[model samples]
Target: MLQMLSSLLHHGSSVPENSPLPYTVKVSSRAKNARLKMTPHGGLVVVLPEGFNKKHLPALLQRHEAWIKQAAARIEVHRPEPLPLTENGLPYTIALHNSNEKWSVVYNNQGRRVLDVDDAGGRRLLLSADVADAELCRSQLLTWLKRQAHKHLIPSLGKLAAAQDFKYAEALVRLQHSRWGSCTSRQLITLNTKLLFLPDHLVRYIMIHELCHTVQMNHSKAFWALVSKHDPLWHTHNVEMKSAWKYVPAWVSAQS
Candidate 1:
């Protein structure tokens, strides 16, 4: 297992943790260029390619300071407050969309140091760990969420495509925090795993939305007309999706 350590990296020695425009730097081997993105909970993230000097972050921040501030302000307005745990310090329930399977979380304080989950079609899951270790619980929940998405969302996409006579080259399910889903010109549809937390209607609408991209690559008038033909209530679904983050537990959403 990989050991996770948390630390801070400030562009300037005088900058404090309370700086209004504070940010985090993530070093990735796959990154060939520096990129900045505003996340729902992680705030501003500066992805730097490996072997890059950290000192240049100050200059880069200066260049995009205005954009960063505007984006941060926009995200803050829609950010949902983290869900509070019950008196027992456990999540109330773990629900899945478009699936009849049921699951429950049980934290084991004296057992092995790992979160164990049981996805027994409508069965309870036991998290064999202490309640105080919220991070471990969050990690386990995120893992379970991804599994649920694959089990439910992937197959549903195929069915939806066939029903609508929409052909796609491929589909991918991921834990993206920025957007719910996307499609490429190659007809590859990528969906966010968090969609499992949304309502059934919204989930179907999103699937239809992406499948429509297989025909209309852009969000032009024809693209929306296609989406409307499939999901007549696409407008309401789109508006409802804005508040879907409230369904996600703070622990998972905070990792964005």
Candidate 2:
């Protein structure tokens, strides 16, 4: 079994004893290219970059044993249960949790990890993990979501653009942790797949807002006018979007 180590900087504190990491870090040579990142808890992750030094990290961990112990203790006090899944190579997600939608989740063992819709009239929207490592399973699930965004958002963005009299150049939908929509000067508009979980009206407003960016890059007065033209009730939807983020499950996306 891979040995788990605690973090050195738990709770965002710089002090060594108060930290939440553990003693004796586990390292691999490939870890040189990667970084030692801490999860929301004290879980240690050694992200390996190219030319990693696997042999050196464990010795370093030994040198800092006392600090690691202190950090682990801190993690026990402040970390929440279910352990925020990021350490297991899977993060929590607040996705597709709509009461109106009929969806289910499961794990499946394919050559690679993936979350896919079994359009076979399958009642469950979620799939089972077909892989051994929890992290691999989550990577596959995220890849599935990315595919869904590309398939669904293109047409949706087009329709919304037309409704607002904006000519669309191109559209790309992605699974982003913090945004509903973003517009670029190149006429490239991106929508977050998470938008699907919002109330229908909010979804409509988000569409309209991004289409408006086709004409204006800034949130200027004319921009507001355009947004208001498409969505007079947009203010309400905007507030809902912010509040809705809280309900999303944890560790659903790539860690920053």
Candidate 3:
């Protein structure tokens, strides 16, 4: 992803003078080159290839300083407000908009650490853990969220693929930090569990986007054309996706 961002930069381009901004440096063995990524939460991240020259970082950052500031400002405009927290700093409810289901969370201190899906049609979650162990509760909640995603997202993707006559190997659900969904060369599709927080239409759009990747791996014009053939409103959904992270509860990423 960082490498993809670097391709947008103009090599040898002049940038205006600006104060150096605080940023984090991450070295990735998979990185073919150094790049800058401005995340909605993390302001600026400089991803460097392993063994890359540290001396070139100053010039590299300077060259991309303008882009970084602009990206940061854009992210700030769409940044989500923090979610409301309970006394134990956990969410009171888990809303899976994609599945059109909302589950109330009832935390119980039973001197045990476990989470149970209530038999009430799975509309309630019974969490048994030390209230003081917020991290444990959060982890349990995250695990539950992944299970929900697995139950819903995978089948939904399969249905969409079948309906559209698209073929794929398999679908999997995971908690991804930087992507909503991804498709591998072997046709395996992995969707982010956080996608459950998004609206149904947007979630469908993401699935379709990944499904399109099975045919066209890159974001070329032909790929988008294919997507348009299936989802005429994909453009609108794509624009809305820029700020869709706001729908995700804060606790989901609290420990991330």
**Pick by lDDT: 1 or 3, better one:** 3
Q: For model 2, how does the per-residue alpha-carbon lDDT over 29-129 read when each residue is reduced to its tens digit?
A: 55544345444333554444555565665654566567556644554564333323433445443345322444445545554433556658754435455
Give the TM-score comparing model 1 with the true structure, all chains together. 0.63
C-alpha RMSD values across all candidates: 7.6, 10.7, 6.4
Model 3: how far is 209 from its true place, Å? 0.7
> Model 1, 21: alpha-carbon shift in Å?
21
The CA lDDT at 2 in model 1 is 8
Q: Rate the local accuracy (lDDT) of all candidates.
A: 0.71, 0.56, 0.78
lDDT (10s digit) by residue, model 3, range 1-256:
0011211121232222454566767778999999877644444677889999977888898888789788777766765555556886798877677887878888888848889888568689888998788888899989989999999989889899999999999889988766788999999988989889888898889989999999999999999999999899999988887667667766774434
**TM-score for each candidate, following the candidate numbering:** 0.63, 0.57, 0.71
True-vs-predicted CA distance for residue 134, candidate 1, Å: 2.0
- Residue runs of model 1 more than 4 Å from their true location after superposition: 1-90, 119-122
Between prediction 2 and prediction 3, which has the larger TM-score? Answer: 3
Candidate 2: list runs displaced more than 4 Å. Answer: 1-101, 108-117, 123-132, 251-256
Model 3 ranges with Cα > 4 A deviation:
1-83
- Quality of model 3 by C-alpha lDDT: 0.78
Over the stretch 1-256, how does candidate 1's per-residue lDDT look in tens digits? 0011111233422342434676777788999999887654445778899998977877888778788888777666655444456553457566564574446666667545665555456466777766676766667767777887888898999998998898999988888755778889998898888777767897898899888988888889998999999998999987766556655555555642
